[model samples]
Target: MNISQPGLFGNQWCDAPWRLVQETITGIQSLKSDVDFMLWTGDTVPHVDSGHLSTDLNKELVRNITELMKSTFPTMPIYATFGNHDYHPKHVFPPYNNEIYNATYLIWKSWINDTSQDANFLKGGYYTVLTASGIRIVAMNSNMYYVKDTATVNLEDPADQFAWLDSVLTNASTNNEKVILTGHVPPGFTTPRAVRWMTEAFNKKFIEIVLRHSSVIVAMHFGHEHHDSYRLFYNQEGTAVVSLFLAPSVTPWRFQLADGEIEPPHNPGARLVKYDRQTGKQLDIQQYYADLNKANADKKLIWSLGYNATDLYGIQDITPKSMGNLLDKMTSATNKDFKAYVNWYNTNANTSDKFPCDDACFKKMTCGVRHLDEDSFSKCLTAVSGSVSLLTFSVYSVFYAMLFVAIYKLFN
Candidate 1:
């Protein structure tokens, strides 16, 4: 739910009470008939003061939502995991002095007992639920291993997590049960940067384990990216090991990027995933975006379920020409550069006409120019040098004039 924001006490649009009641009801109603189990992909509580009321409020909200669901679907089960924001970093140790953690755990335990009939539930954020169709859903807490030391948060993929995961996957595979794994973080970095770099060794190991039982592992659903997206990863065994499904944020946090694209206060939404029990195949997955203008909008009753694979498609190949080629194909015409192509592509690709590039000319050169020809590459360097020389001389002339004025003033 991307539960963030401090105003959870009131039932206003911007407050927790309103969002909770609205989203919970909306989610329940959306999947009332088709879904066998309702799985929450983490971030259940908004990260606020690590106190009893703060934690209790979140728990109460969940409890209320669970009761609401039960009233309709008499015996349906709801499962959840812990997000990094749910508990303070220091709560996971021998020195665990945090009252909030204890309180939160107690609240969760009570809720589980009250709401679910599942026997395999554990205290920590890891559990397995068997569906009526015999499909197993394994939910794990990826947030427990992270530690904040000084300025940086160290996210060491816990060895215990891997061991537990391995056992679960092995059991699922051996039992011939189709498994759907859930977590908060995506496997690797979608954005190429330092801070976002995840544990490569752990990611590879996890993927390898999943691949080993690829035949039974259908999909891995997660959140935290706050974007509706998906990626297909193939393993060495020639099996499409896992289909990563990221549900969109329930709150409006970020915006869609391409030009003319809808900016902030984006359409908040969630996903409805449908799986075929017989084939272990995902039949149809729909993304439902909220319509703000409607009454009880947060209830998501006035929303639309668009059938697009955007929630599952990973980062596109942004390599210039490939992007340009896509643009050309779409319009059945050639563009001079990547920017122009992207601009054109964005306009024609979706209902929103947004251009991703600002400098079409530069993108064109970067996309079209190759270093294969030594002479051409050298000539391009010379031209760049000439431009630099002209700019350098212009700057020098201004500096010289300033220096002369300063010298004259000093002499006078």
Candidate 2:
């Protein structure tokens, strides 16, 4: 559909039209001089149903986005991942090589610039690219963790990605190189619903892998939820080890899901992460976004800073420790920190119909952020929410006690 004036988020139903994509690219190009490389945690295709799409159509869509990135940043490298929607059948990635993989390898070979890692990318849509000194970028096909990817979901080690990830991380640790992990879907539930992206078993496995290699990994980035939120990876001791940043999508489509869940509209957001090239330590994330409503109305896009991570959250840096502290602040719904959390965490819609961020929402989000395993997430809600219920009962008891004293005084 050709929609020019797509308003930024309360009830917009249109996908990112071509003009919108062009304008978004223009906004990104504004940072060409300062930015180094790009992390395109993928979903090049639109949110169209599987029945209407074909393998060729999906391939073209990937190619189109790739070419746009190439044209925008001619010299800069873009490490991309395979999104579930990039597949024709959508979320049915196989353990074995396929037609699209080979095609993608050819289309992306220039950007990857390393034919040495060709085999793995062809086999299971993943590869590693070493940047400057002491840094490596592992573009994993996390779509394997996706629950609807039935071909590999039941398999204990889909695409052998976990094993490969372990080996890669082990190698990075030994080489004294820090790795930046990039993928499509992250290991947490969606920002709103405790939606199932990956199955419980896969999520658990993914979390284990992160914990095992937490020391060697410097930063992680993913995109899929299209919601501006992040996940905290904690070790068995409940200490945060790694942080995964989920960048909001360029597409502002409040997607029509099968289950009829509707997310409030959000402006198109792109994050520019500042980091130490030597240590691979992320310094900050500069989130840039255009007011979809204003831009569309004005017939031009003006991207501005939505917020900076360290500054807004009052955290020292974008690390697991700081992120864990942020999560802790978010525990209380009435707190100002959580108020800001709801604003930015909901993609800054501030729409009238925007859903309320109640204590229940906070509980689900907290558990989702802390526990990557679905089972652990459920258990966390049970333990925490159960206590909340008990606290409610205690408050009722105190109220009744006060009431009885007042009644006795009145009788006297």
Candidate 3:
């Protein structure tokens, strides 16, 4: 979601390379022939200096991006949610942020369809849109679940969103309507390396909500990790409930690992997801990434498909059992090739072989696997650690605190 300060990268880590954003929009428009709609999971503002940005500036950024998307695909419906950087004085997105919510709501008015849901969107950037085919699309403001200072937050409102979600899903189930939920932050940690985005407590609750409604939920989507990845939510019996796709961003930013390792610059990426129009089941996700190096050389900009969900991950179907089984195998250390594929698909940096992914980099990709089946997954990680640097226990402790301090200061 980050496309800020076009042409400005400066020296900041993970700053979205804004110069390529226009090209990204062009690439997205080219997908109109294939995709039915777009799900933009938040963060239109730059992460760099986010806390210092005024509310007006943030609004302008959101407006500009929205206008561009509409112009690019005027006929296709585009739905969005709030990213942490979308709010000014960054990450302060309570339901009471009336002015901020009102301004942003108008930008997405036409695409949202249901006028009756505007009040809910205004109160908290969450709403439901029922399609002409009776499929329910629930958009959530998941930024509230991220690591933040709880003292400044509205304690009751965060829980209120979950209650509201319970009611929405219950109604959707009663009507026998298939549902697809979309949001910014995914419901689990980005990696078992450590909790990267949402608090552990909130993440568990979010997963429980998804599991309770898994029977009726067709699929779920998220953004914010910027890297291409997916989460397999499973029940106590190790059966997968749903596989949440975390669509990569159209902004190239650096990713830092827990071991003080800074990854090479990632190429900006986007996803073209196809779903069955009637049943609301996701068929596959086509990942497209822009090569910044080639674009800068006056070469024609190319947005190539990295891979499709089915071809890449080898899941037989969308059902929980099939996907959970696929994830269990992928996380196993014995499958070195799959680990390497994830490293490559995660970003454009892997394109030139300038910096090959090492053991530590590969571990971060598998860390999310534990969420799928902890008992067996722990055994897999233990075996994998024997061949990789799996950082010392003390280092993990310090890394967690260090990341919190770094992100808190950056977003403050």
Candidate 4:
């Protein structure tokens, strides 16, 4: 967990230095040795202009990462999905197998250890593996549903993934097997802005499928947000049924939004999850991170525990009901618990002063988690957006009224 004068893990506010990746893998090995598998949600390539990248470059990037991963943990199973940037053009994934998918499947096929997954992965960049423990891992190509993706914008069920997903979940249920769903792009809205990640139609369908099969889904894990967050999915009955965990990026790069404002930078982070192999349930999550500033100053990269889900948040378990209660508690962005969530949102990045997270931000995030459906999300915001209590509002009204009277009297 220590680097030399060798201490600098690269720019804290920009793309990660290569050594950081190595350190992250090493850190994980040291921190948690019992890891059975890895769910890698894509974006193996660095974020750069298209002119600076191409099909060949994309394949190269994926190959390099895949090689490193294979060599590092030769025996462990690793499942991956494509991000918007994983392709040559960066945001267009056609339903058919193209050059990028072909090369990617070849590079990553061995990781699955199941030749049965080849057709799906090569066809539309998705596949599922039935693990030895009877737990099915569904690696979804969510990039096809991304807003920036143009290839399948007009097509319904572009890759027929929804149909495939429903069938998979149904089969898993029939076999009395649980599933761990992994994808790159998540459904629902973004945390930075209350924007949907997928098109309304696609997002709606995705949410519908999950809610339909909520009982069989052990957990849904996604990346691409580049921030640590979680979404709690609800059943048709409006009960919290599942939880989606979004792990922070290994890169500490701070991205600027379309509004041209640079996001608050966070330290590079990873998580060690304790789960049930038999039930495929995520029991706990231990977030670990390296302070970029501290590492550079101390002349060593040190990965330390950021927070424990059950310990810091006081959630009994990582179940959706427990997490739903936690979400309710964090609705007010100003609470101590919510403040800690903000801190870890960027892996302890100090944005509390320069980039203040007000009540509106909290509402958007919590609502997004509460309701994956777009309509419900918007309604949730409307129903629960007052940062000030009713009593406080009344007090302010009274004070303003008295001040207005005094000012009027003085003026008259």
- What C-alpha RMSD separates each model from the true structure? 17.6, 13.6, 8.5, 13.3
Q: What are the per-model numbers of colliding residue pairs?
A: 8, 1, 0, 2
Q: Each candidate's TM vs. the true structure?
A: 0.59, 0.89, 0.82, 0.89
Overall lDDT per candidate, in order of appearance: 0.43, 0.73, 0.63, 0.74
TM-score for candidate 1, please give it.
Answer: 0.59
Task: State the lDDT of candidate 4 residue by residue for 279-389, as single tens digits.
Answer: 777677888888887776776788898888899899887888888778767747788777877778878875443346787777776777777787877777777345322
Sequence-dependent TM-score of model 4: 0.89
Q: Which candidate comes out best when scored by lDDT?
A: 4
Weakest lDDT window of 10 consecutive positions for candidate 2: 397-406
lDDT of 4: 0.74
Ranking by lDDT: 4, 2, 3, 1
lDDT of 3 by residue, 161-209 (tens): 8898989999998998888888886766555343556665666667778
After TM-score superposition, the amount by which residue 4's alpha carbon in candidate 1 deviates from its true location, in angstroms, is 17
lDDT of 4 at 397: 8
Tell me the TM-score of model 3.
0.82
